[model samples]
Target: MSRRLEFSPTVRQKIIERDQGCFFCRRLYHMEHALPGDLAPKDIMHVVARSHLGLGVEQNGVLGCRYHHSLLDNGNKGLHREMDSMLQDYMRELYPGWTPDSVTYHKWL
Candidate 1:
């Protein structure tokens, strides 16, 4: 079967500019493949996650490496929840009233 693929050049450029290129490792101008795999070059994970209310927008997303992406996906929820709590600590510091449950995503986004 044949499959069609789509990617947003505008979003890619924006992410490249915003992250100075690499997302997870924070490198610059890294090359990326269309999908994730060992053959895929080091690049950002521009997720359109169903759990994050993400609309493929640059702002409503995250940057991660392939390894980290896999870890985040298959890692234990307790660890993930801990990490989320730590992240929320920073978010609450900025927003003041942000709660842990407010931005928590059951799935990676």
Candidate 2:
């Protein structure tokens, strides 16, 4: 049996803070171009889907605007690569190389 995977609210907030804009198009609030005065909800997307055993943690999250989020969910190959590359870059920048496991998500869990 597969366990339900979930990210804590703190992790979701961290993802929003880290990925200030959409990973795909850099839109802060909406799609590539949001209408003036419009406010669209942002989505915390998984760089690797949960079905693929992706961890429900900050390292695996990216903030995406609604349109891009759907595009990712619907299997846009190009966007997948783009998001993966971005996540890898972020991981390197944030962690450099493997540190003690305790320094990673150990404390969070």
Model 2 CA lDDT for position 59: 67
lDDT digits (tens) for residues 1-109 of candidate 1: 0111122577656655655523433432222422445324444442433344334444433455565555445544334544344434544555577553343343443
Report the error of model 1 at residue 49, Å: 2.6
Using all chains and alpha carbons, the TM-scores for the candidates as numbered come to 0.45, 0.63
Q: Residue 87 deviation, candidate 1, in Å? A: 6.6
Worst window of 10 by summed lDDT in candidate 1: 1-10
Error of 2 at 84 (Å): 2.7
Query: What RMSD does model 1 have?
Result: 9.0
Determine which window of 10 residues in candidate 2 has minimal summed lDDT. 98-107
lDDT of each: 0.43, 0.61
1-109 per-residue lDDT for model 2 (tens digits): 1222467798889988887866765634225544433335788876666666566677677777677767667644456566556656666677677222312233236
| Backbone clash tally (model 1) | 0
Off by over 4 Å in 1: 1-7, 21-40, 46-48, 51-53, 82-109
